[model samples]
Target: MKRRHFLQLTGATLAAVSLVQTARAAQPPATDAKAFRAMRKYANLSFGRIAYVDRGTGDAALFLHGAPLNSFQWRGAIDLLSPYRRCIAPDFMGLGYSEVPEHQALDARAQLEMLVALLDSLGIRAVDIVASDSGGAVAQLFVAHYPKRVRTLLLTNCDVEPNSPPPGIKPILDMARAGTLADMTAEWLTDRAKARATFGAAVFVNPAQLTDEIIDYYVQPLVSSPLRRSQYERYHLALTPNPLAGIESRLAHSTVPVRIVWGGSDTLFPQTDAAYLDRIFPRSQGVHVIPEAKLFFQEEYPSVIAAEARRVWGMR
Candidate 1:
């Protein structure tokens, strides 16, 4: 079946399930602020002092953030999952407090190698990876090349196929490739409102959570450092056709258990891509779509995502 048609059917099925559960609905608990604060820390890795926080203990669970943002993106979800498993949220090179490299090697292979080296330096042999946005592509490369190192995989709202990127993304990719960092930032990156809307529109199942404070947290790192724009440009340039093509094919042959969690409201990649991914891994379970959520579903519906991760890891 076509991906769009599959998603439409899935949406209808989920809506029906929601109706059944409506009668028993109850309010979710408030997020724990103290726990969130406690989980915030930094780690020094090989490439640079890539900042990361490791909370709780037992199996290792690495949370890889998307473009523009860093480990801070996983704060809320880390709080929930930390109680049951060791959760590590690392700022990708050039993002967050991580030191930006002098050289321009931010592509998938370089980033994947950095991750592997970081894990080895930390003495961790294997981990369950939860990656979103650009990080999803990084995770795919890591698993494909180092399959035994990845215990499980969770991908959200990221596309590996060059032919299947969402409509407007191609233009942005082209812009990032051709333009200077200053031009890209002035023309696209620094707009606080646009950033909020772009990110909020992509991941949050609840639009109401796109508060000014949340937006500021996301935008702060980008603006705080002068290098942010250049770093982003280098990262974009690193995304070559070769690595992506290889990762796409490897995903089909992967033996590692995989789960796809998406926000139904995501217009960036669209929930339709979920079907394309499902076909690649037929043994993988069906995609789980959080209704009101957008691309950043992990931020908007962390508890739901946390629960799903626990299920995949067999922790609870």
Candidate 2:
């Protein structure tokens, strides 16, 4: 073969191989409930037992999830970030796989206290927090009071200023107030079709991504029994009328560095809320609007969340 022809053929073969490799990498891994099921750990707090996912080792990264959801929301993000950081995701009292006590206060203040207790129990002194929705409100309260313990505060499509629960969540809250939340949630838990119509519509922008495993993870524990259902309602009712009103003063003076990532399409907590959050935190890095995302955007873009956490941690 001529030398030029031989070189061209070799290059073409290499390009073909590269393309094949890239294509393989682009395909997502198989989704399985077992693969994503985190090792459930428990912390015995004064209020109740807090179930959490404690994985990896190194600097701590605490993940706080929104209402009507739990630590499962942070599973994908933990899988990505756990390699370099100790990822801790806990189920707030009255939610998820955690033990729900009828006597405890499940409000933002109580949740914050429980968070401190959990970290203390884990012996985690300092952490970077990644919070979403109502969980963001809890984190805000934490960062303000425990500023020294939090290294970086990352907020995503969360409660801020004027829209604490946001309008989209009002209907759900209304149902909870009306004593119908348990029945509605139980219906969705048992019926995939109902879940598709309700949970899918309310929580996710891309319904196809709301796999059977994800639905089971969210609803099964809450609907497991009557006590759990009652606990769920109690938690919802525990929410204070103005959870963020008091936090505003502290947020304006927070020393911990802040970063905001908004799902550009999240009607529950829109970009306007993100903008308001950015303004309140004196040390905010700024807002990152993911145009194709919504409330559970971290699940859609775990890599982005992990990257930002690492960047803020100075590990990348």
Candidate 3:
């Protein structure tokens, strides 16, 4: 498998990128109200209709988001990186606007399979992967099973083997099992105030950063219907089992460069997990810990993600 070592951007490749920009000026805005609603697309993969956002033109950069959240989670990151890579953000089968069959298995392995099919459908063979939260767990699975498919990986606060389903997530997990997670999320959709007070505050550092549009984008689809609500519960419940189990050896031997950008304030995934990743990945690019940040810092800190992405892609 050929790796993306564009240590220096060639003039020929630059010309092609420039040509595309000239052909189609002003790509659709990704970080705005109409995102995931107006500009979103759907791919008819094996699982079902997979929702996604495709922007720019070049090599693909796949962005996988956390649970309860969809492709909207990466709007900020995509906004910055799209100019360089054809940024692709897909909502997993059970979450977001993806219309999945009720019978479809909503688990780690299933999610990985869906991604493979989705990429194949998109005619993209390889990608630079940027993943967050539970999406990070699925990203690990993708790297373990399909190592060559990934040129580079950028992971934010998420699950690692040592604490696969982090202790802090127990409450959410419990809510899922009791079938109350969906209702709670529905309430969040109905009462944005309650959501602003709890859900936003739990995931983000400053609750105010999670605007009404964000809350609506993240929560509405999850509980828009009975099927969506049930799938929402199942999605969280699937994480109860350690998804990253036994992949340590495969990851340790992986030649794919991985960068761990963790948040200091997220108790769900401690710094020790970051150290674990650094020790495990043979080509680990080192860790970047942002103080006072929380789990969804990827949304809050796009510049950090963009800079690191450029570094990993050898664009800088």
For residues 1-316, write the lDDT of model 2, one tens digit per residue: 4444334335533433443334323323432456546388888888788899898999899999987888878777787778888999999888888885767788888999999999999899999999988899889888888889999988888887688666666777788889889888878656887787666765566677777778788888887888888889878876648688767888889888776777887767777787677677777766666676778877756766766666557664
Using TM-score as the yardstick, the better of models 1 and 3 is 3
lDDT of 1: 0.67
Task: Give every collision pair in model 2.
Answer: none
Give RMSD to native, each candidate: 4.5, 10.1, 7.2
List the candidate 2 regions with Cα displacement exceeding 4 Å: 1-32, 36-38
Between candidates 1 and 2, the lDDT winner: 2
Q: What are the lDDT figures for the candidates, one per model?
A: 0.67, 0.77, 0.83
Clashing pairs in 3: none
Residue-by-residue lDDT tens digits, candidate 3, 116-203 = 9999998999999999999999999999999999999988888998898888878988998898988888887668888879877887
Q: Considering TM-score, which of the candidate structures 1 and 2 is the better prediction for this target?
A: 2
lDDT per residue for candidate 1 within 1-316, as digits (tens), equals: 7664466447734643443244114324434434544555655555766667788788889899986667767776676788877888887876655675577467777788888887887789999999987788888788879989999887888765652344545656786777554354442334656644654555565555666655555545554555766676666556545456745677788888777777766677677677667667634545776666666767655666676676567654
* Candidate achieving higher lDDT, 2 or 3: 3
lDDT: which candidate is best? Answer: 3
Task: Please say which candidate is ahead in TM-score: 2 or 3.
Answer: 3
